[model samples]
Target: MSEVPEAEVVFVVADLAGYTALTEAHGSKQAASVVTRYVELAQEALEPGTRLVERAGDELLIVADDAARALRVAARLRDAVEREPLFPTVRVGIHAGRALEQDGRYFGTPLNVAARVAAHARGGQILCTEEVRRLAGEPDDVEYRPVGPVRFKNVTDPIVIVEVVAGRRAGEPTAVDPVCRMLVRPETAPARLPFAGRTYHFCSFECARAFAERPEAYAEA
Candidate 1:
């Protein structure tokens, strides 16, 4: 067996939220297509900044130049997939401290931290370490909510976390779904029906119809 090489590499861990539900609901073929599409979309958004080297199950391992670019790409990945039906929401976990490279694979505390971040994301969010935030350029209206210190599954230090706000396009105003707490586009979700003036976005027609069926019920809730 070859020895692990210590080269201080930065690793990225990310995944799709509700992926299992999607797969079970759509079946294997459809699930594969959507998962593949999601991977492609994320790759497209993170290209030129990070290179995807390994894809396993619903998780991805990407190596980047440094912590800064990794965090940037994480935000981009979440933004790229949040609106698409392929993946409801993408969550990212990034820890950019150090890693050992062996046989073209990266391993270390950073990688573990990133994996934990990805694991902890609620929905359509990015969880990253303070080290990553240190390298992250600047706050551009993206809320970096502090998640406090967390003791990860592996490694020593209790990593600090900050939630990365999803990126928005130019000339676009962010819309939040009052019902389910998801961000949606005005043009994309115009079909959504609601009360006098306010509009709500549901993950699917089922959610919309459910809301429509009991307007007062959801409105009050």
Candidate 2:
């Protein structure tokens, strides 16, 4: 048997946040519509060097030639999903490493790490390991916020994670859900609460309740 070739690539795992609630709030048929639309947008967001490896349920696995390309695709997908009315926000995780390539599918620790990284992200957020951040360097339009170290299931050693932000500016007419970290339009958010003399917006009542329970934890500085 021939050995599978190893290639260095960037992996991105993205999924819709609040998908279950979206299903429960809107019914299964409508939920399916959102997923279908999201898949379409995901396909459209792919650039020349990027590939949509596969999609399962609300999550997508995307491979890019480099970390910068991965970030661009992730940001584009997130923005596209959010632009649709009533669509669930997208969260993404990215990592750059070597993976075994065979049968048009990749397999290895990089994939596992990327999936775990994505799992730790909140809606409207993009997280990547330190490897990806170093490879991606620094982009003018993107800001990297350090999330410190995180431990993932079935993975050895802790990986440093950082949040990537490319959409919206400081003065944009948008609010970030304190609990879920979802980016929402202030006018359209389903819930809002006053804390520390400031108003916070949320995509749903669940997140609002969570913030209410622990305002000190999720409150912005």
The segments of candidate 1 whose C-alpha lies over 4 angstroms from its true place after superposition are 1-4, 137-143, 169-221
lDDT tens digits, residue span 47-93, model 2: 98899988888889999997888898898888787777656778899
Q: After superposition, how far is residue 37 of candidate 1 from its true place, in Å?
A: 0.6
Model 1, 1-221: lDDT tens digits are 76755765566788866666556544678667866887887688675657888888778888887766776777777767765642456678877765777667776766777888889887677887778777765656555778989887655777788887646744333554434434467667644776756766654565467578767755633
Task: Provide the TM-score for each candidate, comma-separated.
Answer: 0.73, 0.79
Instruction: Pick the TM-score winner.
Output: 2
Candidate 2 regions with alpha-carbon error over 4 angstroms: 169-221
Error of 1 at 18 (Å): 0.4
RMSD of every candidate to native, in Å, equals 4.8, 4.7
Give the clash count for model 1: 0
Candidate closest to the true structure, highest lDDT:
2
